[model samples]
Target chain A: MWDYTDKVKELYTNPKNVGKIDDADVVAEVGSIVCGDALKLYLKIDDNDIITDAKFETFGCGSAIASSSALTEMIVGKNVKEVEKITNQDIVKYLGGLPEEKMHCSVMGHEALEKALKQLKGEKVEDHVDEEGEIICHCFGVTDDLIRRVIRENNLKTVEDITNYTKAGGACGSCIPKLEDILEEEAAKPASDKKKEETKKPLTNIRRMQLVEETITNVIRPILQEDRGDIELVDIDGKNVYVALRGSCSNCMVSNVTLKNLVEAKLREYVENDIVVHEIK
Target chain B: MERVVYLDNNATTMVAPEVVDAMLPYLSGKYGNPSSIHSFGGDVGADIAQAREKIARFVGADHDYEIVITGSGTESDNLAILGSIAYYKDKRHIITSRVEHPAVISLCKKLERDGYRITYVPVDAKGNLDLAYLKESVDDDTAIVSIMYANNETGVIFPVEEIGEFLKEKGIPFHVDAVQAAGKIPIDVNKINCRLLTISGHKFHAPKGIGALYVRRGTRLRPVLYGGHQEKGRRPGTENVAGIIGMAKAAELAMEHLANIDEMKRLRDKLEEGLLSAFKNASLNGDKEKRVPNTSNIGFEFIEGEAILLYLDAKGIAASSGSACSSGSLEPSHVLRAMGVPFTSAHGSIRFSLSRYTTEEEIDYTLKTMPEIVNRLLTISPYWDNEKQEGKPINL
Candidate 1:
């Protein structure tokens, strides 16, 4: 189960505008039986291209259902042109906020509304396709450039955090390794820049360990400690130092990078030359 | 600790004091391997035989000697399905349902790679097996028909008895994974006439790491795991003495309490009704009539199941979801999918499985807390904007 917000739960428990209108002017549906979610949007369009009434029937999670209901509610008296402009982000922001994984559910609502609007206008809406120029995750239809931009902008440290920004690994989850590759590629640039700053002066191995321990105790421990986690320096050998992580960090998948980038980079910044931090298994 | 409100009975139940007392002597003073040729071993073997007879009597099996003890429910399922398929190597066809537990489903998938043809039967919207389809699919070449007695997700009981009779008439071997239904419902292998049945000890309040498979007399089942001749050459391994004794005692207790099962059913119904009445647009999954007495799958239209479970956990309540596993995968349950449930509502489904131990107070507390939680989550939902659009007053 995705950790839904209070708003998502409300719409799920007592969804509004369910069922269908018999005399609906335009009806639109999206998704398929295999996707595990489907939505049917019914609209009552007036002579002036205004939506007099709107209702929806959704077959999806709370987020999808709520998003559809929210989309219909948002567009019920608005013009067809206005409904076409409503994006998934607008639906999510309207719902207070949705969990990152469920952001796709909101996208479904936006698509359903747009399709309904196109039907009402008697216009041919192009099928949703990843045009040649679009940088999609390929595995899940998320764009690679969008994911990269999110990582660079948010200073995202983990792949899970990148999911919150771009929803790259939420569907099918085949794009996860690719997402990691992007995170690593983006994370390497800053690391090398910091290493360049430390290369100006070289110190001894003992001084490096002391400096790394200080940074961890001051900077890293406080943040991880909030999650009932901690980092410890195990052994310092030549330029390689081993650290044993405890609490939540021990079971966390991304701790390896935390040891490498955050711990090692900070050590290299203030301490000796070519210090490598290794995680104790 | 007031028994700690053991809602995790679905995982395992507390050992009955009587069952513990019955096994004390064998665990300590009478400790001996049942396989030895000495007096000490003979005494332990007698105790084992007595426990097996007690288990056989509870399930109404034809022969007590046919019951073979194994390491767990997974082991029992593996031994029954894989062992049977291997024994009948000439027959390559096997039939099973899509909603079966992983124990049966994964094994069937593995067997499919080994030159076996498998037909995965689909279920109705209420999780009931289509017996008409089953009859049409079964042929002379079909080696086995494996279906679960009841689904662990929705507690929807299958028509195993009917399937058993149909398969028996055709001389095709039938196997029922009765891990969830055993002790909770009445199972008569004689009436069902199934060639094999699997039951997990932990499911019925016995200790974990022990289960049994009922192989009818003269059934050809090759051993999957080979080492010792403990279970009449059918399953080779040392007996789990304590677990088997505990299982026997749990079965005896289940039989004694069979008449009072309606109490649990009533509590489950009360919880379901309360939730439905308190929240609008809420609906139940699976066939209401064919479901187990103590389980209910409810879909709250706009909330995610994980959010509800987390809130419930904070309030000291425990429940499960069929939509996604704990690993955070977004795949809706295969059981719900086979039933043709739409994905929109599938992710919002929460399963509340009750046991005989559930109390009216617990139900009352749940009823009171649920509506409030639902309202809180819905207040900020973009879905609720529909109410505002219709000029309806927002409650929150």
Candidate 2:
């Protein structure tokens, strides 16, 4: 129905690694019985912190199942630190792309990866958060912080978009009114923030370009530097900011998405929403 | 695996050679407007008359003029219900089943927005219609009672003849969407005693874009389309001459092969029996005995259906899934959901429909290949705990 890419169809029909790892060092499961799709991830990490193997068990639609399988394939031989950088869009990119409604399936893959890493790091996982300021979407295990952040980052305007992205109100829909309130609050946020950023903008073109370079240095450089990758600001033409992806980042499968979503998104949040980032080969 | 085992016949059937032979003349040398004054065009009109007569005979309509040709099964359904409502002015209520095809169901929804009250009768767990509820829901204001003769998903045949008689007694018009039932089983419109009945050519063996609606003689109805007088001022448009000719040939073939349909039933039963016995936690959907001859809707627990369908597709075993993942909308089939099937099972239902072209060898291939795919998906499924799994899920 989604017009699934050949890769998604292939992996779903013949998944690479399935079932649980008997001696899996880090096991993390996300998604609840209330939610339609559920996924459990198992990671076998070696002494040097490289993931020796990974496997997954999923109960969901074609995209959910395929995303889980792709996630398993993605992190199998990578370091735990590098695995932590795997985003929802990375899984989506690995499978060509999922339908917008099925984007939550890719989000599940990202969360499963995070939960497993938290386990490996001896960090506490929220098994059941009944405390106040926690568990806003009880139908799903969606925390208030996650919902607020997704709302802010994606500039999500409605409860339906939130559901499509994070699967917050996709279940019983009891939390829909609550989600609407949160959405209202989040919607009012970026306008004031944008106004504040606009007030601080330099009038001169040279100063504006300098500010763009400084924003890239302060915000996007550190992220790419971690992956033995870096970015250099090439030029700024009006709203378009051109940058060359240096090192392993250029060869990375999902670097284009990272450039648009991660780099450009951060630039827009920090600088201006009108900024359109382009990779200089 | 190189060979295909097509089992999605309720979706569409392969055109017969004879039907194609009849259509070739209309497509090439005999292209003439039936309404033209030319003798060549008049001969085409004569051919259409003969074709109409054959289709009328096939459906047991009393008069050939009662058969009005339309663009498709969907158009025929739209034309019948909409036409009946147009002619019957002041009536504002409609009744249909929960599992009617989207052609009818969506139209009813649109009508509801324009101040029409529509009652959707539910079905039992086995996909059997609730006749008592249907009879009780009918009223003097009811415009038309549009119901499907057989379900496209589960192949459950409704009691159209009984319902038709009951509606006739109430002096209310009835429209039957027999697109799925027409060729697979007998359709006697006179015996049905309905105001209208619709059947598509492609469902039997003709090419797509051709269908006929049976308007009982003197059952006043309006046309959805407006143009030249092709179907006796009922469906006014230049005729799809080639398609109508093919449908006539196909109808003749369908009548000839009507008894041989039991062969499809035997293959379907073998396929259903083999799968049900071979796999644990596998079961059937709809009424086991009341279904059309060549359909088997099977539900396998713990795995989603689109994955299964894709796996089967990769293996060249054509089938259809009722899961939300298979549909454009992210909701499980309305038919399965209306039947009160559990979320676990409903999300995993697959419809394997056969035709006269099906073979035991194809069934054997399907029976052999399906369990392997099911077993693989089940192992990958989180709900299907291997530890709880018994000796072997698949008998083979």
Candidate 3:
């Protein structure tokens, strides 16, 4: 049912370098049978740091095997350093394309090659270690570092993108909130740095007013609109800005929490950190 | 050219030539509204009556009126479960096996969300329903108990007769989803004593849009749909005349070939035995002797099933898998997982289902092509190293 490319189908049927090199320079395996896909790569790297031969044994679906096969073909006769540059996207490109859900197969191939190079360097490599962060998704054993790296490397925009690339939050989905936190953090990385620069300057009274109005229109009002509520900037007096909650927010039980946590937080972040808000009842 | 061996009949069947022949006149020349007062409509109504008679006889129901033609097996299931719950407003509980088809399970889930208590009777590793749990779960508030006659994935027939007998003593309504069992095996309302049973036309040799629900006489059911007096106001709409005729024809043919079920069994056994023997790490997933004659679910260790299925597909052999990739999820088949099939093998499980039209040659082709495919995948599988490792049990 996966719309695998003709090249993927061809490579899966008659995968090249399927057997293992018994006396190889380095052997690296990634994934597990429990996770539904695993791959063991046997590499024969020569003295010049060039991969003389590469073979793989993969336990997974057709796309996984095809991705492994493509990885082997792409790495053979190439420098070990250059092989490190070949990302999962490169393997996907070699196979023409894989279904969005099966992109993790190509990621597995890229990971095996990375592990093989690390093993060839005589480093003590442990299987399944993220090398960047702790495990976040227990079902798939996807670490926070892996999720973050994929989000940054692939310019991932949604939780589904992370699942497609790294298989986080694709099972059980209990870690979905954690993945969302990571995505938000990664997405705000550039903006946060820019915010620090903008925060250092002294706030002109007019600039403070415009910034407060912009934050309300662009951020605070939209959040309140989700609950069928609205807010109006009644008046602004220096650090104290007076506002009135309208619609559903007028008599809401948690309107105070919304004002402090949502409204004041936006004002502190966008305007001066000392800005105070007053509700005009 | 490839041989094109179709072993996915459990998913859907090829429309038989005879069934098409029987339905052709209704599609064109005999296109009369069965509800009309004209003679043209009267003749069509008479044909529907005859079809109903044959279908009633096929399922061993007492009267033709017991068979209510619906759009699909899911509709019949909805009609039975929702209708029973609606009829018994004071009762707010339902009991169903964990492995019932999504039609029953999902509807139960919706009912649960609607403030109804649902007791999902678990099954053992062999896919047998926990009857003691079912008995314990039933209370005064139990509205109905819906269990499938045969599992669609594994084809493991449940002890519906025993369940029926138990529920009969308790005076609780029982519904049986017989979609997979209708044409493959014999079904008798008298033997099972079920209050309602569902059948899909396409599961046999009929077209896809027709199904039947057998409601035992005196079992009051609120109509799920309302329009006209079609299907005696049970399913109200214009009747799918040709589909109903085709289903009746399929039922007639099914009755005629009831004795030939052994032939299908023989082919299935041959394929199962050959594949299980060909691969040292392979094993059967469901109850070997208690399954339907047409189905064989096998688990091949180490390798994933979608890979094997794709390899088999390339060889012109069609099979299905319980693997996560095949199912469009990261979790493998829930049925297999519920059976406690380890993740290692559950991801590698494949199902081959046969039909009455299967040939021994097709079986031979599958037997010949399967080993090479498994062997090829095994060579690439890191776990396949001439030794068996008891796979770790997965929580999914």
Candidate 4:
């Protein structure tokens, strides 16, 4: 059985605002029955852009209902900005916590709130428009972009983690290969600009030589030699990788930028955190 | 607090008082090893033999030696499937249904990865196995056909007797998982004429962790576990004496209560009929006529099952669901999915199973209280279309 908090049990047993509003200022529907949870959030806002009342109609499990009810209670009497700042985590906090499997219910609550907030702003609800990415999971209608965004934001590394966060590939599991591909692409990220600044490892003489040779073969030389620009490993001392530009690179005018931008940046991905490539005349 | 109405017997059963009484001696005082040579220990082997004979007779097997006791139904299943496949090395095919329990289904999946061709015979929308497909799929190299006597989720009994006869004619070994069917209905290995049948003790009023496998006297099976001479080298370990004794007593009580199965069936029908009458947009999952006497898998549209289950739990009622919300996954039970149940209702499916101990008062209280819960939930359901007077089925 799920270890539900007493607050969740209380709110679930007697949800604050249920049923759709008659003449609401904004109505936002998120999710569908196919995904096993759907929440339609109804909002009644004042002239000053303050939410006077919030009601919800949901077709889902206990956590989903609890989350929608909790979302309604949290957003009522709060201004638009404050309501917008309330995230899925905020809703979960209101209910103490939800089971890890039921976290998607809170996410559904957040989606409904965001949609209602957008409608209140007189903006398009962004439903029925697959502008971000094509739907990969046909069962739940989850898009690749949604899956990618969840993976990036949560730093999720596996398809299972993606399902746990976004409900993507959780149903039918036919899109698992696509999810795997996206996970592989995300995990295969190259070293960033920030990483190229610092070289933390103190290198021994033999280790420095290994780093110099490895960088030349694996990183620095591959791209340069492809463009008829050859680089030879000269020596390494401390964080500096000394190299000689050969072939077309010898006469290249932009070799200075190339050495700093491509060579140094690429080498930092593999060899060390900080390694400056200096051309030896 | 109201009395706890247990309708989850398919999950596990309460141990009968008599079974406990029969097992106490073996559990405490009679702790001698059954394999020992001394008189004190050798006497325990006679008790083990007596229990085995009782279980063997309960399943209507001719000889008691054909029964091999094991830890649980899953162990018995593994022993039957893997053991037969090992004994028949030249054969490289397995046939089972799509709705078998995970114990059978997952093993078939592993066998597929090991380069053995496996045919998962599909079922109809009512969860009936496609026997023609099973016949067509069987070939000369088909190693074994493993089909359950009754599905755990739906309680739809398959025609295992008919299935066994045809498979035997094709010169193939057949194994029946009678774990769910043993105490609920009559099972005769001779009538089914299958080479192997597996049964769990806990499905009836027995303690958990004991099961039995019926292997025809001449059937060859390579043992999955190897240690000592217990279970005639088929299952080589010190036997669970207390558990086996409890199972034997459960089997005997099951025979005594066989005449009262009709009464349990009547109570089950009352619950099914009452729930159906009280709720709108609800439907039964499996075939109504072809199911066991005590299980009703129902789907209540527009509300998630876990939500209903939690409410029921609050009211001192016990039931279970294979719905997506009940399971951690977004898809419901594979049994429901394979039956082509639409996603709108499949997410709210519930399985209510009754046993011999159920009373009419409990059923009456459930029938009275459940409608209120359903009505309460429907008021807040977004899919409850008031104008149309029914919960609207969401277009997937």
Name model 1 segments beyond 4 Å from true: A1-141, A146-239, A244-257, A267-276, B1-8, B113-115, B139-141, B325-327, B385-396
Question: For model 3, how does the per-residue alpha-carbon lDDT over B97-169 read when each residue is reduced to its tens digit?
Answer: 8888889989988988999999999888888888899999989999999999999889999999999999999
Task: Please give the TM-score that candidate 2 achieves against the real structure.
Answer: 0.86
Fnat (0 to 1) per candidate: 0.12, 0.50, 0.84, 0.88
- The list of candidate 2 runs beyond 4 A from truth reads A32-36, A45-50, A77-81, A117-185, A202-271, A275-281, B388-396
Model 4 C-alpha lDDT versus the unseen true structure: 0.85
Between candidates 2 and 3, the one scoring higher on TM-score is 2
Q: Rank the candidates by TM-score, best first.
A: 2, 4, 3, 1
Interface RMSD of 1: 8.4
Candidate order by DockQ, highest to lowest? 4, 3, 2, 1
For model 3, name the residue pairs that clash: none
Better of 1 and 3 by TM-score: 3
Residue A279's lDDT within candidate 4 is: 87
Q: On residues B1-396, what C-alpha lDDT tens digit does candidate 2 reach at each position?
A: 377788999989999989999899899999988888998999999999999999999999989999999989899899999999998889999999999999999999999999999999999999999999999999989999999999999999999989999999999999999999978999898788898999999999999999999999989798888887778889997999999999999999999999898898999999999999998868899999999998899988777888788888888988998876676444578899899887677778899999988998999999999989898878887777688783223111
DockQ of every candidate: 0.11, 0.36, 0.44, 0.57
Q: Highest lDDT: which candidate? A: 3
Distance from true position, residue B315, model 1, in Å? 3.1
Write candidate 2's Cα lDDT for A111-144 as tens digits: 7888778878898876643112578777566888
Worst 10 residues of 1 chain B by lDDT: B387-396
**By lDDT, is 2 or 4 better?**
4
How well does chain B match by TM-score in each candidate? 0.93, 0.97, 0.96, 0.98
